[model samples]
Target: MGEMRAAVLFLWIQCTSGWMHPKCQIYDSGEDLGHFLKWTCNYLPRHAEHYTAACEDVTAIEEDLLGLPPNINTFCISMANGQNRSMSLGFFSQFQDLEYLYIDGCFTQILPTGNIHLPNLQHMYLIVKWGMGSGCCNCHIGPHTFRNLVNLCDLTIQGYRLTAMAPDVFHGMTQLQRFIISEPCVEDLSEILCRIMNIKSLIELKIKAPEIQTLNQSNCSILNTKESMKPVFNNLASADFSFGEIPHIEEGALAWLQNLTGLSGAFSQEVLLRLPLSGIQQIQYFSCSGSNEIDIERICNVVFLLSIKKIHLANANMRSLSMSSVELCTGLEYMYLGGLGSIHPSPHLKWNFITSLKNLNRLNIDFLRDKNPEICSFQKQPITWLTKLTLLINIQILFAKQFSCLVTLQYLDLTQNLISNIEDFAFMGLTNLESLDITQNKITQINANTFFGLHSLTWLDLRNNPLIHNIEAMSFTHLTSLKQVFLGQVNNPLTEPVIKLNLTLIFGGILSQLTHLYISSAMRPKGYMGQRVQAG
Candidate 1:
């Protein structure tokens, strides 16, 4: 009895003496504290050493964060109303072994200012939500604020109201590798680049500023000329400049970035022409989006000069694309062209360019109008050019007579179109086709010979179509290799209940090799036995 009393007394002393009793170690102060504790005790008892505190109507932070566990490595503090709260200096003095700190939706006006030191800290994320309130002050990164975080490697600051960052804000962070600023609060791009040039080890940098317009010599001159005659970002391999309305890229501006391999942005034809041709030729991947009419001549010139393997163009007018122009980039393997508007290429123009791409393997083109019967007149001419093509997406109608040339095609997507019927032998020559998606269309019924020739087809999707209640059983009988079928949510008027389907009769013996089937409840009638079909 005496020993039991002594043990109990010892535990009580530890709890009050800042030794952190195992049960009372992790402290959570929030509106859902009771529920959080119950869940932690039941499922995550091993992680009870972590501490999280919710800030509410608090003017000071030192009093609430004092006397924490000495071994605490991760600390999370979130403000219920970030606009009303702020952080002060020396607030993290107790957590000496802290490595990761996350401050979400907090800190307004300014961060802590002092000889703040976090010896072991490696990753920090500060998200300030100052834009939610009206007439609120912007957050500022004061000088010497992050001076003592010598070991910090990754830092992310995301806030709409961040207005200014001192030139030397990241001065002492020599070990920083990845820095991301979403809609940065800074006003000048030059200021950001000047500071980023100091970090030599950074490999990936992303700046998403929608308000900025034009990246010219003023902001990008640092990359053109280096102080020590060395590359500014010696290791920068990938850079994204998603600024709005970037009209100009001065010549020799990006020359110093010798190791850059991938660049993505919406650039104008004039800006593209002015780019350092030699430097850009070294890039292996390029993605460009713009509203200006695509200059086929200049684009072809770039393709001929560069050894790029993949090219993606969005919102560019391809009305002027010609066979001769496309034939210049024979080295390209993957091409994705989208948002082409209502322009439809003639049958000869489409066939000529596609057949000319001898090295092309995957092609994706969207937003083109329906394939007119006039375009199918080229069926008389044999198209033995697409022998190497494997995948085609968002192209015109897939009439078997017109597409029989692509004997090696494996995957085809004909979704989001005005396709109402799949005429007999629509995919007759595609013996190697593996997957086909005809979803989100106006298809009403599947006739017996609708899919007569897809011998190697393994997966078929007919979801979100207005399929008739009664389907011909032999419609899919030819697909002996079929493995999965999706027939969920047949399009029906809101006022009417979904029409049920008889699975055993519709699928017949086609389910012999089927492994997976998806159908909605609306497609099943009352008193239906799903297990009986599997048993048979």
Candidate 2:
């Protein structure tokens, strides 16, 4: 009895002396200090307190304070400098609130394979960057790795070089909604693709696997669906690839994308086969560059782009526009075709393409100067059928062609191509043209009657074009409705020598309406000097 009393007294002194400095293992920096302290008390390590009582104290907090009802919701194990990094499976089973877990740095391979049964973890982020460790093996089985994340809604796994997930990485994650993989060197994105093949309920998945600097070269195989399972992803809404790139899925692999109402990408002509929509009903905005290749009919009907309001197809080798290509698109309002390969009008091509588009108000056709050095597919009748239009034509180098009759055209974009010489008959029948943009082109000369029939022309943008050497005194004389003129390239050396408007004779009153005059950089300054000489 005396010895027992002395032991209790000794423990009392130790607990009082050493309990002040608590060692908390798992924590979020964003948590408040008081909350962290409260949590720390539950996970704190005791240095000396009649070890049994210390353990009892921890259990009391785990049960009473954490309110853990024998269900593990979280687990955290620290890795010391020299200790083996694998935590015991018993440690994981001790707490009922073990839904989330984190193991820092590297880990041993033999920690415990197929040892997890966590069904409650809805959001998880694993930060592992292991090397050739002895605790794990080249996994090739099911009910393993991420075996029991069945109810997991969000899972994030990150590492420098995680070779590959177990074949059944997401074997039973039936209710999983979001999955994220941030390993830069996830050379085996295909493995992950296969794992999620059956997760039809997953709505959002983001994959990001760029080349990691520290990883060695690795080979990955093309993904294939399981033979017995014709899994359909009817519920998926959005997917983001690891590197903003994906292997072009086979012909019908993207039949599932039909349900996705919104998609965002800079894909161009060659990758059009990736969008395999069989019955999409609500897609609207599309963006692409020169390399995208998608079928116009497939995109319009099956991809359900009737809801699309804006389209940007620049430099996409688009030579002709067919009426059926845009038949079902009722919501299309703005269209951009600049950077398109062909600029010349192919009269032999169909002209009724834009005639059916009732909602189209803005149309842009950029020059081919950047790729072909000249415009080759500019058809005038393509613009004539569209009853109302805001046109933007950009011709970099000079090429003379008679403008087709476009009576309903409004705003015109003629910027950054080869239009150095302006012909009097170029814009003859454009009666409703309100704005003309010939910026950043090769315009070195102009005729007095260049814009003869443009009675409604209000704005002419000659900015960034070498305009000083091109403007004749009569170039601006006729357009009585011209209100705004943007001339002179920003920082042009000649703009310093010539500031006053010299073309007052072409049409004197037309120059007086010029209220918004911008010379490169006024309210905003395009700081760099353009290489082309504007005959300054």
Candidate 3:
């Protein structure tokens, strides 16, 4: 082999390390990415067939026949960032292995201006936006022209301005399994998405029109989506039904969302009501985001939630959910319940709500203080402190001691509370306590041996307070595992000799084991003496 050819082959070996050979250490081009690409394809044309061109914004991948390897697998041209005078499109068509294509940004001359027929192509992503008229104005993938990619499996397009998607736009991808179309509101996604069922093998369909706003073009007053709903998919597992603001949603008529494990969109009571819960036995994720009145009760009735592992009911008017059984959803994992501005987080209103989530590893209960007047009321103790700290909340009274379930509790937050002093044995039951935070509170003095038996305690917070003074030497002696202690506000006693901080108890003894300590500016070690009190 020639020296240059050998060098290229070696570069290819480096480029496909994990994919080609586990032991081979290929070359590292460092800052020169173009050099790496040139050397790689030059030496290993056979191996180059595996380089998926799924993210090439042609404008950014300016190549004039120099980068095309005959056997390339994927060629995704996502050009959403800048102008597209063919960032490099003038010469990238030669890569025969292109499969998944994801293009974004403006299009000038950098677009596939002709019928793109790459046999190995499985996924095609074409995102066209306002990038029209410069040089991109004349480029085209005309009706039924690019349908020759029969082996395509997945396709995604975002922000393309072509008004119509011919009936056979995706007619040739026989092996297609997943297809997605994301575009601006100016063009209808239904134009491209409605024909997916033709690919028989299509199992996953995603229509993410995040910034696209749909306007009833035909009548301007009413919505006519029937043209895109007739074809039913038997294998679709996930779908994305999102757009800007939904002007109108047809109730009791979502015929297309019957057998899905995941669903997201501007849905109303009807969509959540008739959802085929019986067929979706493995639903782990659910989102009802957007300004919609979701019938929390009707939705809870979808017994399939019993199979749900994680649920996101964000941005909806969902009041209360009564999930009262460990057997109800044994596989339940995580729950994010903070969309209802009026929904308050309280176990008392309905503690039976999540008791059944046996496998629940994480739970976030967020209540809008602006919506729930009750949250604004300053009570003597933290409102929702569950005794069974088996759950995690960062408030006052609802601490571990309040519940038997807290045995598994690892993190405890006591910020901005009425906790004045570290009560003796306050942490006695917290056998698993790893970190403790008492920040933004009124902690005057840490009582003697305050952390009596918390041998596993590592982090402590005593910041943002007023009366903190005199750290008793024996206070944290039992905390052998204590690594970093936050006492930045500890009354500096080094200044006043008459009222010196009993450093003999702190530094001279066991407390010396502390590696990190924070002290305040007011009290000195020599003259530290003052009326320290934890203000409520």
lDDT of 3 by residue, 155-176 (tens): 6655543343344445556677
Extract clashing residue pairs from model 1: 162-185
In angstroms, the error of model 2 at 304 is 5.7
Give the candidate number with the greatest TM-score. Answer: 1
- List TM-scores for all candidates, in order: 0.72, 0.43, 0.55
lDDT of each: 0.59, 0.48, 0.48
**Higher-ranked by TM-score: 1 or 3:** 1
* lDDT assessment of candidate 3: 0.48
| Number of colliding residue pairs in each model | 1, 61, 58
Model 2 stretches astray by more than 4 angstroms: 1-243, 248-262, 266-280, 288-309, 314-332, 337-352, 355-359, 366-404, 470-474, 489-507, 518-536
How well does candidate 1 match the true structure in TM-score terms?
0.72
**Can you write out model 2's per-residue Cα lDDT over 382-413, one digit (the tens) per residue?**
45434344323433333233444456677666
Locate the minimum summed-lDDT window of 10 residues in model 2.
Answer: 48-57
Candidate 3, which ten residues in sequence have the lowest lDDT sum?
369-378
